[model samples]
Every structure is written in C-alpha cells, then in structure tokens.
Target: MATPIPPPAVTVEEILAELDALDDPKMRAVNERHGNDIGVNLSQLRAIAKRLKTQLEFAQQLWATGDSQARLVAILISSPKKYTAEQLDTMLRETRVPKVHDWFINYILKKNPESESRRIPWMDDVDEFVASAGWALTSHAVAQRVENLKIAELLDAIEAEMKLAPDRLQWFMNECLASIGIHYPKYRARAIEIGERLEVLKDYPTPPNCTSPYAPIWIHEMVTRNEGASEVT
Candidate 1:
C-alpha cells in the first residue's frame, strides 16, 4: 500500500470547534451527575487527540483554554516526559472538572517519571482532590508492586481514614485497600477485616454482573478471577 498523507496540523481554535461540535446535552447531564461538566464523549475526544498526535505546544494551548474537553485532548497529546513535577502539580490543581482531573492523573502523572515521587506528598496533601490523586497513584504503585510501599501502613491509613474521608478521597482510599488485598496474599485477611469493619462503600449499588466497590467484595471477586486464570494457565 502507498503511504498515506498525514492530515495538516489544526490550530487550537479548530480543535475547540471540533470539541464544541461533539458536545451533547444528554451526555453533559450524565457527566454532570458524576461531577464532570464536559459533554464530549471520551472516545471521540481521544480520536481527536489521535489526529493531533503528540504536540506539546498545542497541548499547552488547549490546556490554557480551561475547557475540560480541550484539557482532555491536551493530556492525550502531551508528552508525559516533558512535564516537571511543579508543572504537573499546577495542571492538576487547575483541573477542577472531575474527568479532566482523572485524565490528567492517568494520562500524564501516572506516565511521568516523577509519578512515584509525587504519590506520598500528594496523599499527605490537605486538598481532598489532590489527596485522592495521591491515593490513586499509590493504588497504581501497589498494583504494580513498586518497592517498599509499606502495605501495612497503607492498610492502617485506610482503616483509620476511609470511612470519614470525603467522597472522592474515600473512593481512592478504598481502591488502595482493595488493591493491597488483591495483590498481596499475606495481607488479604487483614485487608478484608478492615474493609468489613469500616463498611465503606458497602451499600453502593452495583449493576447486575458488576463487582461491588466494597473492598472485601471487590477483593474476593478479583482474587477469584486471578485464581481461575491461573488454573487455566
């Protein structure tokens, strides 16, 4: 096959136009219920980023627009390695929209070299959202088996804090707790005990065939799946 011509580069305005056109009122209402105001579908936003490719400057311009959809595209196109810790922190703080904040953490900070370095500090941060991000980073680290994570300490914190934490923070902390139980066989009992006693997310409704977010239930479900997969292997 002959080589295809790449699409010409589009400016931020063009990208913004594309994003605005993609906006859906129904989608916005749904996202609003989940703490995000942006109406653009994530898959479509990602498709736009695929066309833009990795454009650091373009990403900066999009992020500067303060439009959540634009910021999502900015995160998708930006070079994870190009950001400094301070810049990432500033970007994270500026990202008030829930989806934007999540994309920034997952697409940028998680892939950045400074990810681990930021995790503890962010977890200790006074800002609930920032601390939630920290717990998210820590959950990722725990799942990946990063060195010296002090699983016991994480469990202790979750045990002591999760039930009283703000909604977002509690969710992430519960995630970390579940991650530890899933990944560390030795701590599985303790993790489940803490989760059961705290009763965090116990009543959160789950759709049919979907696992519950209550840490013990989540831990058991994931662990069972892993065991079955291992047996298959």
Candidate 2:
C-alpha cells in the first residue's frame, strides 16, 4: 500500500501570525467603526481557511484565542453540526466583535440543526448580542417561510418593542420586518405600514446604487427586484 502523507502542521500561533500579516490599517479602521477591533481582508482570511480545510478542533482553538480575525477564520473552518447547542450559545455570548458575531450567526448558527429551536429563547435573551442572533435567526426563518412561526405575534412584538430596542438588536428586528414584507404577500401591506411608522434605519447611509435599509424602501426595492427577475425568466 502507498504511504499516506501526514497533515501539515497547524497551530493557533501560526494562524494568528498569518492573520496579522494580512491586516490592513484602513480595513481595521473601518471595522473598528463598526465594532470590530481587528481587520484582515476577508477574501485573504477565506483563502487561509480554504487551505486549512475544516477541522473542528483547530477551529475551536482559534476561537479560544478571541482575536476577531482569528474567530472569522475559525468560523470559516468550523462545522455547525459538530457543536452542541449549548456550546453554540456560549460561543455567541463570547463573541464581542460585531463582524465576528455577524459571521458566526451567518456562517455557523444558521446552518446548525438547532437553529429553529434556539430562536424564541434567544430572541428573548437579555444580552443584546444574543438577542440580535435570535432576531437574525428569525429573519432567516421569515425569508424561508418556516412553518409555525406565528407571524402575527412577530409583527406584534415588532410593533411593540422595535422602536426602543438597542441598536444591534434593532437592526435584526428591522431585517425580520423587511423579510416579511418582501416574502409574504398577504402581510406585505401591514409590514410596509409598520416599517414606515417606525422608520427604523430610515436615514441609514446607503452607498450609490444600493437600496436603502429603511424597511419600507427595502421591502419595496427587493419585492420589485424579485418581480423583475421573475418577469425576465
């Protein structure tokens, strides 16, 4: 039989050094403004992750280092299915950087089997970040139209609390509203009305040619885009 080649050496220190080597001051400044203290070009970080391949143990070690850039790499390498729900929850709690927190929710938690189960409890969590994750999950669910989501109850909660929600939590809540307005035709009018009334993120700076994040405008823009694409086909 042919001999199998050994896996390449990998360590947290080496990965940290690699991340440091890729860091950019301009990127770091932009990230810091958005609550991420460390910034390595995400494309470069993704390349490092692709080279390492998926290793849950190595990913965990990187996560433990608590460097935002390292955690981004960790998120890229980690398997959502390998983690217990409790461990995922703990990781979410420990994620203090905005970029890292967003990536964990987007790349890991969204793929986890326990995601739907965690949604309500997390939505109610006292911690803003955790609650934001819950809302993020909820927004995903809304877009996917997952069963038994209590749509009326969601709109009710948004109508009642979204105006006063902390910034991070409020962003996700706004997302959920936009998702509902964009996806569910029956509730579309109500969603738009709610969004206009609250005006959450209405004045949020949008780059040239980018749709606004103001829920009402976002709902309209996305709905129009989807319709146009449908017509093209």
Candidate 3:
C-alpha cells in the first residue's frame, strides 16, 4: 500500500500570516454592514478556522493579539468546552466591538457548559455587553427547552427590569419572552401578556412579512406557527 503523507501542522505565525494576506476591501464593506468594520470576510475566517481546527490554547493566543477579524477567527477555532467562566468573563469584558460581542456570545458563550451558570450573574452585571450576553443566552436556552430553567424568574426579570434595561439588553429580553411563548405553551399566555405590557420595539422598523420584535406580535406569530405545525402533524 502507498504511504499517506500527513498534513503539515499549522502554527500561530502561519495563521497570522494567512489572516494578513486575505484582507479584502470588498469584504470589509460587507463586514461593515454586519457591524464588523474589520477588513476580513466570513469565508476567510472560516477557512482559517478550518485549517487551525480546534486549538483552544492557540486560539487564546490568537485572541489575545488580533484585530476584529482575527479575534473572530480565534473565537471560531477555540473550544468553548475548555473555557472557564472567569476566562469567558474576561473575554466578554474585553469585547469593544459589537460584532465580536455578538460572535462571542452566540458562538462561544452559548455553547459553553458555564453558560447557564453565568446567565443570571451576567444579567446582573452593569456592563452592557455582559448583560446583553446574559439575555441572549437566556433566549437561546428557553428556545431549546433547557431543563430546570426558571421560566418564572425570567418572567419576573422581564416584568421588573425590561423597561429599564439597556437598549441592547431590552431587545434580547424581548426575545427571551418570545421564546417562552413559542416553546412553553404553559407560559405562552403570560409571555404574550408581558410583551403587550412592555410594548418593546413596537416602533422599530421591520421588513414586510417579517416578525416584529414587539413581544405580542412576535409571540402571536410563533404560537400561530406552532399551532399550524401541530395540526399538520
């Protein structure tokens, strides 16, 4: 049998070089539309992430010294399972850009074992990004039907805090409410009631036929869809 040659190992320096080489003005414009002003596209970052594979340690090194796009690649390549809550907190603290903030929350924090543990504490944090992360995580957890998640507590938080929450956090809080309505039939009525009371994002412009973030509208659409699906089944 012919011998198979192994792929050469990728080093941090090689990865850095690749990132620097792939900078594109057109991609930068595209990224700008997504709140990433950094000059690298998703495809390039994905390619680097694919090449580096999962290297938590190396990913940390990359995260420590990169621009927005590089840090994004780092987030993609890192193993969230290996991150401690404290370490993740530090990363969250360091996030200055909206794109990185969203990526870290959705891609890393949401997948981590510590996510549930951190959600409440993060929601309590005064930092805008941390609070946003908490709400975003809660929304995802509720949608996935995470066991033991205190839906009552979430509802309480929304009732008491949603009006006063920072702009970004309020948005996710609305999402969490919609998730409750969509996934937990028992809580659906309450979720819609809360949404109607809060009236969040009611004036925010939305595309035609798109679900509005105004909690009542969002919950109603989701519930209607669930009913349609159930009837079909």
Candidate 4:
C-alpha cells in the first residue's frame, strides 16, 4: 500500500516572525505602498506580513499534498481589510483546524509569477472580486502617500506665471502687508516725514540743554513721538 504524505510545515506565527525580521527600508517600502493609515514601523509591518505569509504558504503546501483545507483561503483574500490584528492573533493562538490557517495565508501571499492574477481557490468571479477589493483598499491607503502629479503641475504653472507677471507679485506683497497690518500709504508717507524730522533733530546737541523730562517717573516714555516711533520701529 502507498504511504500517507506527511502534514504540511510552516505556521502562521513563524511566517509572521520571519516577515518581521526584514530590514527597515524594505518593510517601509511595502507599507508606503499597501499599508493602511496605521503607519506601523518597519519591524511591525514585517512581522505582520511574515505571519500572514506563513499561513498562506502552509495552505498551498497542504493543497499540493492532497488536502481540502484550501477552502479557508477564501476567508482572508475575500476581505483582508475587514480583519483586525486581535482577530488574527486570536485565530492563530487558538487554531485547532489543520491547514486552514495555511490555506488562508497562501491565498493572501500567493500570486501568479507570470500573470497579475491571484489564486481565488473558488470561481473566476470570486478571485476577481477579492483582487479588486484588496487592491482598492491598499491603493486608497497608498494614494495618500503619493504626490498628486496633476495638481502639483497646476500649482507649479501658477507659480511660474506669478514669476513672469509683476502685477501678481505686487498683489501678493500687498496682501501679505494687509495680513500683517502694514498700511502701505502710511508706510511710505511716514518714511518721507521721518526724513524731515530727523534733519531737524540732527541740529540738536547730543547733550540736551534740559535734563529728564519726567523727574524719575518715566524718563523713556517722555521722548517725543517722532523720536519714540523712530527708535521703536
């Protein structure tokens, strides 16, 4: 009689551990491409992927060795985004089902090397649905990280036009002045007025004929408005 094939190797925990061991940059690249908003550190991403992959690999191995647990792969790829870490951990920690976790893991991590299609373990429609859903979730998350090239180009063109147009530049400066409470009319007028005032003050001797204007009460604030404004601004 023919002998029975041994059970498949590789556990969800082991896969997770292996993935976690990847270098920071590699893990970061993957996260930047597919991770949700969680922004998990590189180590964390690796660990998660490793655990997920182990389960996936084991399922594939079981199918190759004549097992029917391949049905479980449908659970993961069908709605990867819906599963939480706690749920995954709980399943792994408590799993008594043989090769089910492996099937699920294989479905998550496996791919056609020559084609973009992921194995559906079911009908073509199910595979297509899972692929579309997984990528939609992944892309939406990654989309935030990638620059919007069209909008960036539009902004750049607007900036370039501003540089070529003096009116826009002047308008921009005027708005900036308005924001800062700088009155343009008063600013220029005051400049000319100060010049005239300074010429008159220049005639005064450095040492004043009179002493402190306020007898020790407030020597500084007693200065003339023209002098005070000049000193402060």
TM-score for all models, in order of appearance:
0.94, 0.94, 0.85, 0.18
Query: lDDT of each prediction vs. the true structure?
Result: 0.90, 0.91, 0.84, 0.32
lDDT string for model 3 (33-101, tens) is 866767766777787777667778777988888477778988988888889988998999888788899
For candidate 2, list the clashing residue pairs, or say none. Answer: none
Measured with C-alpha atoms, the lDDT of residue 122 in candidate 1 is: 94
lDDT score for candidate 4 against the true structure: 0.32
Model 4 residue 3 CA deviation (Å) reads 4.4
User: Which residue pairs show backbone clashes in model 3?
Assistant: none
**Model 4 per-residue lDDT tens digits across residues 10-54:** 554453344335335654455446421122353444344344443
Which model, 2 or 3, shows the larger lDDT?
2
Let me know the TM-score candidate 2 reaches against the reference structure: 0.94
Runs in model 2 deviating more than 4 A are: 1-7
Q: Over the stretch 14-102, how does candidate 2's per-residue lDDT look in tens digits?
A: 99998888889998998788788976878898999888888889999999998888998889989888898899889999988888889
lDDT of the structure predicted as candidate 1? 0.90
